[model samples]
Target chain A: MSLAEVAKNPAGTGQKLKLQHLGMVYGQDAESVPVLEDINLDVSDGEFVCIVGPSGCGKSTLLNVMAGFLPATAGTVTIDGEVVTGPDPRRILVFQERGVFPWLTVEGNIGFGLSKLTREERRQRIAHYVQAVRLQGFEHVYPSDLSGGMKQRLQVARALAVNPDILYLDEPFGALDFVTRVIMRGELHRIWQTERRTILFVTHDIDEAVQLADRVVVLSSRPARIQDILTIDIPHPRNISSPRYLQLRDDFFFWRNPVAGRDSSGPSSQQQPCWRYGISPFSGRPPRSFRRRLA
Target chain B: MKLPARFRPVLFIVLLLVGWQVAIDRHPAQILPGPIAVASGIVDLLRHGILFKYIVASLFRVTWGFSLAALLGIPLGLMLGWFQRGEMAFYPLIQIFRPISPLAWIPIAILWFGVGDSAAIFLIFVGCFFPMLLIAMTAVRNIPSIYINAGRNFGLSSSEFVTRVLYPAVIPQLLVGLRITLGIAWLVVVAAEMISVNSGLGFLIVDARNAGNRYDLVVAGMVIIGIIGLLLDLAMRSLENVKSFHWSSSEE
Candidate 1:
């Protein structure tokens, strides 16, 4: 079947992903440290969910569990009522490091997962997505020759070419500079609108979450559990200057900040509360206890 | 004034020839032949048809020995690298043998093959095998897990995974191993020819020294061997010049 038809039906027609009491613990006995706890979430089909959390939070572990790279310690994740076993091609994960194959050219990487297609169909699909990702002249060029932003775009194209129903992006733009990151976010948002794939993106950037997500899922620090799930009622191509946009963004900032837990007012501090956390919003070392991570 | 890089080697050779002529003027031709005498020796051999015969004999032995080494070593390496159990069973034995030089294998080769082309080829094979095997094993082991994961996710069959993913990933480094092994094989064949056979460059050098104490002929044989080794290295280097193979080393 064509990717559009598959996207329309998806693996789960109604509910795309279901997580219940999902918890992850590393090591055994006294050494074992819990990374996630009592996490329960239900995502609808074709929804764009942005999961925002602190730096050391278990967002990545949760994404890995959902992508079937890691197994949950306590609970189960089901898609279409079937428990997740291991990584499936139908649910592709886009990593931040630009996982485009360095050995292969742009076309080669895009056509990597298109082995099931007939030769002609593979060519057509590869061409379509290459254009979709806006990499026109670089089809024959190796990824090493491409710019950093171009390489990441090529990676996104490779993921989309497979026509996966769910795209799990783990800080896909985290490595890029500010300008490129903004541009990438716009391109990604446009692609999501066109493809309508269910995306669960993890990031520490609240502005990014506010700009892109249909619903933002806020996560607490280590051994993270769902703090709150705020629906972004603001429309797409949201004006950052608008009162409603600033209000929604600050609302997320207030919920995540520990200090904000003290005072319910002062939404103005929402300017960029995510930059510095746990200490004063200005600067100083985080508490020694928070800095020490177990190996 | 500085000459171009290509002329530097030619200039060095000319200066060496002038020095050799001066040295030969002071000494008798019996003990040390001059460049002129060595050139005459080479011409005489070529006129007598022995030059082509010796060159062909050495080339033939090297081709058989090095080809066999590569055919066996590369696959064995891939297997040992791919399967941990295979490596566990075989690697200790390889480690034991790898330290010994191919020259040490000369006695065993003579005993096994009994003074012929087979003995010479066996020595060359011993010289070439271990380096190729180790390099190929390293190449396979060094491949990033991401590539394997990508292969699996893309639905590549096990055979396709090996041929398409593993082979391409391993080849650039393997080519480097092949070049080094070829150099070793060339070195071994000469020594092997000196003892076991009487029809190669090595045999020519030994025969020239022993038959009539023809020092000029011996020097000529050494010169021929050096030139041929340089040509083979150049041929192998041409593979790296190819654009597709060039970028492979830069890949993660």
Candidate 2:
């Protein structure tokens, strides 16, 4: 459905976001290389889409281009059929690194860029996000004092406060501990249910992708191109222990595992490496690889 | 950070002072005035009101020069740090000029500005500018690219990126540079003052030396400089404490 079907005409009803034949390239000279290619996706007015891939794949690049943070070497991202030219308050991207304004407290961070609202209006919004993110009573504390999890939570509150039509979260929980990541994933789902907004998330964790996304799109290694898009028929508040959950999680791993077409994914110790796009994990040394078996 | 609990330099200082007192009294040399004699001369200078006037004049000169250097150096350093063109073009020239001693510039400063506070301050500026500028530029460049990209991804313009992200990221390093430069300024001020200034701590020491080797006045001036440098560093530390918005200790 288009954004026009879900909401009133000007507000965009049916389709909230559409990426048509998207491709991205970086570097100016002979080094120029495509990061994402031949990407076509349509997210409904209020759907959760997660893109998972090997670490070096261009998942983040695709989202960055959609947010208008990077130039798309080919194709276009449109909202309500209008092409994205630059970052708008309508589309806010929250990153994994916990990009909180150190100078601002929990409240101030949420209220930043909320220039259109009055002081009272902003206070109400700040208060709302504070509660939403379970960051209550941290209003006066500067970002420096918060733990890693709290800082990421603050980023979430800040992005949500702007009432972005579609939120872009680039591995928002990647930096957190396993426990915190699970908790935040749950909280994020709760927020989506309450707010009912479209969200595009990027993560290398197959379990995380399976847990959060209504549909999971897996991408190939460097010069990332979409490999497959799996619609998750599993119900909300998914149970990882359930047979269905385990199967969906296995499907993601099976494709990403270079040796999945063979019997074993690989030697238990040598799981497929997921290289993040754009960044050279190590210029000279070997690629950064996490070999822990997912299945 | 406060000194380590194991640090008890005061006992060592007292022992040194006692040793000085013993050496001077036992030898009784005219050229090497004893600690008591130096202490007496310091009292005498203070009583006569000369010490206060000289210290104030020296402070006036140093403050002007150091502050002026910071005003010029910080901006230049920030530019060098932030702008690729400026860094590539000016860094080599700055590196070459940086190694020259402040005294080398003193003679030129006197020729250009004449023998007064202006020339002395110019010499001090020369002493402080390079290190402060280099440090500031380094701080600007050292900010992790993650922070810069965060700003860019948010659609911050170039100026916004610098003002909001770059400057804040560089503050801790810049403050450290400020502390080092201030100490250098104090050292340069005293030496610069000794060359031509008629009324300052440097002159007082030289003037006293001219009249029968008044070691007391020289020792007193040196002690005063030490005290001032200590206080300025303390001030910078406090400023750092207040400005630190993120607690780094938690991470490392």
Candidate 3:
């Protein structure tokens, strides 16, 4: 989805957000540093767009700009024909950290931003999303009691309950263990299939990008610019270890290992799509340290 | 396996009281109050209701002053820390003011706000504000950018982003900051009352000292302060425990 498409109609179906040439910079005066550059992006009505990139890439920056938490140093970001200067209830962000209010239970967290609906309507919406996320028994549970995967699921349910125009996720599964991550991936896809609301996902996981996005927008390393845009045609249940998947993954990581055999104190261009790639499943043998994490 | 871990502390308190009673038996009643004398003094104060009155007065001061500080401090701290440019503008001032002791502000507070309730209250606010703000800002600053990013994906507006998204995410640290501020508030309460207050527990001790430093009343007053502090701390602790569990299930 491009800003041009979003602007032409202004009100585009369930489509609620649009960004054009959004760029972000931190600091002021002499030390001002650019974080995102020349970012042209869009979310078609109910389309799930996953942004994948190398480490330190501006993926999160792009999402923050869309959410209106950070204003783009240049370029325009419009949502439903309105320009964004700050956060709105329309676009909600689901962070990796527990975003649930400590004082509010799972049910309350899901109901956090629901001022638009009547209390009864809000409760019904909460109930629906709670059931949708498989958190029926734990609705009264405090965020502290849930496991990592369960917490993320609750966040998803919470965001869904509010019924925002778009849902933004920043590596929501990046911190989970491999098993939990796999489980979250499945749960996420299931939720997305039902809601079909526009989702702008930022992840360092190539497989996660490939699995979730209709089109994966790969970003470059720091001062991140768009590197490549790959359209993944494979449907759900795509195998990551399959030849085509591996080949795409290889290309996603630049198709050549900068440090295949060479070892150096420097970065060695060995940077993976995400932190997990340090284990390099392509090596055929999991490094001893990586094996310890499995244990 | 069922033995109480707290048994030793209870035993220790009992033995210390017994030793006090025994010493008082050997010493003069007027000079050294036995455990019984202090217990009776406590009951007498309760019966007279001065103890309860002082408790209310002190609780009011602590709650209001600390609340005022928290209201202003937390938001300002979060703003300074969340935005890089704001941090650059405000951090130097925070660093400079953070180390100044709250008690040191007593003279200035009296001069600015006058001696009665305002002086005492200003001291309490200052006592808690700097430290609470400092910790809150640090917490906000250290929050990974990922949390803010998550707020955007949900289509949350700026206000919601801060209050709904960013606020809850930094809550674990906010609780830590609250713990620190509560302690600071308690510390300031007595010292703040000491300057001019005529009715708090601090005044009780000072008035007792003026009446020839009557050990029994002095000891009684100190005990009252300690007990109330302990109870308040316990309340804050339980609040945190309940909140921590709630936070886990919702946001984790």
Candidate 4:
């Protein structure tokens, strides 16, 4: 919906975030390179939305614009019917790199944004989040001392402590190992279940998008526009081994790589190196032929 | 089978002393004092109390000059680094002035302060200020944008942003700069005292040379300066052990 439509029917529409006709271009005139174009999206209160695209497809740029770190060349991002002119504490962005402040201890990082709160309130909130993220013992330890997963959890705890209305996660687990990434995703889902904050996550991993998001918004290669939006009809605590899950996962794969879906020459045609096609083949169940080879 | 790390330095120092004594044994004591002569010369100065007085005088100049430079340069550099326009305007000017030796400023310092502690202190300040400023500026520039963005997203006001983000972020690098700049200040104070002051270690060396050729006292002064410089560096290095600064280094 457009900003005017949202504004006119503010009480009826429960959109926590509305992006209308968003466009972004770097530089000016002859040097200008377009990144995102003619994009529109609406996210309801407490909705979990994920944006998935190929690498270097302006996914980060889109998140930056939404977080108000960068100005869109031609759009208005309205949250709760108010225009987003700059960053606000109510909307926090968690970076892919361990964005936890290395200088501050775990408790210190969680308490960083709570400077305006009274001492007792701040202490209670920090303690609550410390336990929430399962970092009970390491409160006084710095980020450098923590393992990669712990550091990412600390970043999440720091964001959650502020009680923000929305959390923008820009490929937050992209730096983690395979096992750690899966563990972090489960941890994030648990947090989301308890916290109920609107989360707009961006990632290149399609499996991550399907596993976490209520609705997955797929974007095409740059001058990024919304190619399709798929709503996962499955319930929470989704069974990865379920036939429905496999169907949806394969559908997303084929949507991403149409040629591979069409050319059904007994897995040989699809045996090309994944990186050349920008496909992540290791995510869920590998192909039957690959599984047989491995066995 | 191997010597402990702690004893290696002591062994090296003993070898150095032995090498020095052997090199100087053939020369007349008047031409070059041996280690024993230099040690005796130090004891003699201490007995007369001039050694303590001269050391204090040199340290006093360095303390005043280096403190003044740090007090003024750090804030100015932070401001310039945060505001790109200010950096663009002033950085080239700083680059032009930074290359000229602090010794070259000796004449101007003397002309302004007129051959005393003030002149020496001014030269030391000149030597230390540019380095501190450059270090602070580069430190601010090197801060990851992620930190700054996170700080702003928390709705920090301008002053809060500086105090909560900029200051803490630059501290690790600033400590390194302060250590190096203080070393420069120490070096500059001695040179400044040689030409413009009457009561510092540099004066003691020059006076010993000119009056009755006390080569023992000259070597004694040199040894004292080296020892004091090492102590100063050790003191500066201890700042890195503070808990807040530990994140910059790999070790816990």
Query: Which prediction has the highest DockQ against the true structure?
Result: 4
User: Using lDDT as the measure, what is the rank order of every candidate, best first?
Assistant: 4, 1, 2, 3
Stretches of candidate 3 above 4 Å error? A1-34, A37-46, A76-90, A239-243, A253-279, A283-295, B1-3, B19-213, B235-252
Per-candidate Cα lDDT values, in order, are 0.83, 0.78, 0.75, 0.85
Docking class of 3: acceptable
Q: What part of the reference interface contacts, as a 0 to 1 fraction, does candidate 1 reproduce?
A: 0.25
Which window of 10 residues has the lowest lDDT sum in candidate 2 chain A?
A2-11
User: Distance (Å) between predicted and true CA of A135, model 1?
Assistant: 1.3
Where does model 2 exceed 4 Å of error?
A: A1-13, A256-295, B1-8, B26-33, B152-166, B243-252
**Every prediction's TM-score for the first chain?**
0.84, 0.83, 0.81, 0.85
Give the per-residue lDDT digits (tens) of candidate 4, residues B1-252: 899999999999989988888888765555678899899999999999999999999999999999999999999998888889999999999999899999999889988999899999899899999999999999999899999999988899999998888988899999999999989998888788889978889999998988989999999999999899999999999997788985677522
Cα miss at A179, model 4 (Å)? 1.1
lDDT, candidate 3, A1-295, per-residue tens: 4423432433456555666777778899899888788877655676777887766777887887787777789998887778988876667788875565555688877886675679899889889988999999998887767888888898888777767778889899988998999888888988887886788889887778877776677676667776555655555667777876765554454333222422223233533344335424545434676344333
On residues B1-252, what C-alpha lDDT tens digit does candidate 1 reach at each position? 999999999999999999988898987646678999899999999999999999999999999999999999999998898888988898888888888998898899989999999999999999888888888888889877656665666657888888768887777888899999999999998999999997999999999999999999999999999999999999999987676666665654
Best by TM-score: 4
Each candidate's number of clashing pairs is 0, 20, 34, 0
Prediction 4: B-chain TM-score: 0.95
| RMSD to true structure for each model, in Å | 6.0, 6.2, 7.7, 5.2
- TM-score for each prediction? 0.84, 0.85, 0.70, 0.91
Give lDDT for model 4. Answer: 0.85
Q: What's the candidate order when arranged by decreasing TM-score? A: 4, 2, 1, 3
In candidate 2, what are the lDDT values of residues A179-276, reduced to their tens digit? Answer: 98998899899998888888999998777887888777777777777766777767777889999887666555443332233334432222233432
